[model samples]
Target: YLASEPGGRHVRLRKKGKTASLTFKVGRGAHREEREVKLSPKQFAALWPGTAGRRLRKLRYEIPWRNLMIEIDVYRGKHSGLVVAEVEFPDLATCREFKPPRWFGREVTSQNRYSNVRLANE
Candidate 1:
């Protein structure tokens, strides 16, 4: 997903193995949806086993404002000090519309900066 802030939001079509998803802001912890995936860890891995990287897990906090939702990730482990807030948009054109808070760090979408798959092996 692309990263962005207030003026609007950055957007990207995420590319994954056989599964790609589009997720965006809703309410608060507010957005809602439904889905059914049938796969145990074993089965899941067998289908699309992921990569290895530094493992990091955190509590995600979503704060809503106007038409945007700021997502904060409080990470644990090697990347512990790192906290990132992201706003997903519909396209790059729209991303230019917003202003991100100063606290936000570099945009890391393509880097897989927060992928747990990479985390597990780091």
Candidate 2:
């Protein structure tokens, strides 16, 4: 789920297969800056409890499209039917120039209701 760190950073701890990462993001929309750090399992466990009721589970798949990559999340547990896709751009220019495939569905960028944290609570 999406959590906010101190100093107004958007934070989330992601477990991809066997690896875990702590990612910090700043700004909003297409120009956000992000940094990710590999976390030890113990470190992940220590911080995970804070998420408590906000936790969500998903299976993520990354697909290549031109120079950009598309990440699709297939949710699990109670939210099993929900699916979401995300693409991060290097800049606004790249974001504007990109075209989605016919099947990509509607854009939900910056929508609070679509965020994992919000969906988790429902």
Candidate 3:
């Protein structure tokens, strides 16, 4: 639950099934850029000791919705029963103009509590 220093980068070590990766994120909100590097389990294990952050587990489903692809996440473990859907746009204009389907519940893009990092900590 450490905060990212002002203008500093945010990094995370993630393991999904047999795949492991180290992700570096810069910027904030909807404008952030992320870069990921694949890692071996042994490498991940070595890095895990020094990494500071919560781990999250979820099942992701990608479905085509209109002109955009919607990513639905079904959380597991402590956060079970939580389902969230997200859509990425090419630009802010497209994002602002996009609309959600009936199945999509309330929008939480601006809600910090629903963010993956926050959810991991919760």
lDDT, candidate 3, 1-122, per-residue tens: 12344473667787878998888878666667778899998998888866454767899999987779999999998899999998877788987788788888987877777877777666
Using lDDT as the measure, the top candidate is 2
Best by TM-score: 2
> Rank order by TM-score, top first?
2, 3, 1
Cα lDDT of all candidates, in order? 0.49, 0.79, 0.78
Model 1 error, position 92 (Å): 2.3
Instruction: List TM-scores for all candidates, in order.
Output: 0.46, 0.84, 0.78
Q: What lDDT would candidate 1 get against the real structure? A: 0.49
lDDT of 2 by residue, 35-119 (tens): 9999999988888876677778888899999898999999999899989999988878888999988898888876767866567
Q: Compared to the true structure, candidate 3 yields what TM-score?
A: 0.78
Judge candidate 2 at residue 85 and give its lDDT: 92
Where does candidate 1 stray beyond 4 Å? 1-55, 102-121
Better of 1 and 3 by lDDT: 3
